[model samples]
Target: MKKIFISILILLSLAIASIVPFFKSVVIEDGKTGKSLAFFDAKQGSEFSIEYIHSIHKTPVREIYQVHNEEILQTEMRFQEFGVGMPSGADEGEVFAQKGENYILSNMKRTFPSLDIRIGQIIANHTLLLKGHEYPFSGLSEKGSWVSIKVDNLNIWQRLIGGKKLG
Candidate 1:
């Protein structure tokens, strides 16, 4: 009986250790409650974009980022109109241009270990564009709330009970 119990424990440990990493994901969570909103496997250099309509400007806006070394790096942003929070021009080494009706800021190397985004209550319509798919902010989280996005390494336990994944 003792040997059998030891064997079972060893197997369980091995299984947990192996199974945990398989579900590791980059997760987005609600800041107020720490509830997970969504997750996805983001490989190095994998690109994604956040699109939303500016509440005050009522113009379309998109921010592009890339995943690298467990962090998200801002690459560029495009917007239809310049508003209160919009950048009038780019800094040194950054490219700013107007393409059609949209102004673009590109060639940025800003890195974020974690990002906080406030969900727009109505007109913002925050959306996540990843790997040719779209995730609506309304489905991922509640409006008018703050969300934290980061690459979190969840163990086997958290993965087993994780939130929605970006399919």
Candidate 2:
């Protein structure tokens, strides 16, 4: 009994220690959807942009609005789910595009001259499992559309901790 008790205590301590630092990260709670927002990151180079916790399986994605420079550029909304593999269901990754439109609204368009957006791409990075693949875009216009981005795999947890880094 004594040995068993000591072993249990050690295991418990180890578990707690492992979880402490993880909880230290900023967590945003979206009360509207009842989904807890966790880690977040913006694209490497952009201004006036943000992304946050989107789902349990995917990473939250946001596009930066570069209106001050006044150049024709393209912006993309990326989303991904962790733990879950790439979207397999015929309609698994279709709702997010509309969801983005419903939730994300900034006055970026008014400031920019041309904004071409090709949203929908399942890009697998070291940390994210991208769903909803779409072709990349070039040039700038005022057209926009909804596109869903879901997780492709959750096994890649280590890769996601610091955001996906390309080799």
Candidate 2 deviant stretches above 4 angstroms: 18-34, 41-48, 51-167
lDDT of each: 0.85, 0.32
For model 2, state the Cα shift of residue 54 in Å.
22
lDDT tens string, model 1, 1-167?
99999999999989778666654357899888888877887777878899999989898899999887778899999998887989999988999999999899999899999889898898999998988898987788778889888876776656656688675
Query: Per-residue alpha-carbon lDDT of model 2 for 1-167, expressed as tens digits?
Result: 99999999999988676544332121222223423222222232223333334344556555434323323122334444423432322232233233532323223233333332233234312122212222131111111332212111122242345232321
Task: Give residue 133's error in model 1 in angstroms.
Answer: 1.6
How does residue 89 of candidate 2 score in lDDT? 25
Candidate with top lDDT is 1
TM-score of 1: 0.87
Model 1, 43: alpha-carbon shift in Å?
Answer: 1.3
lDDT at 157 for candidate 2?
A: 43
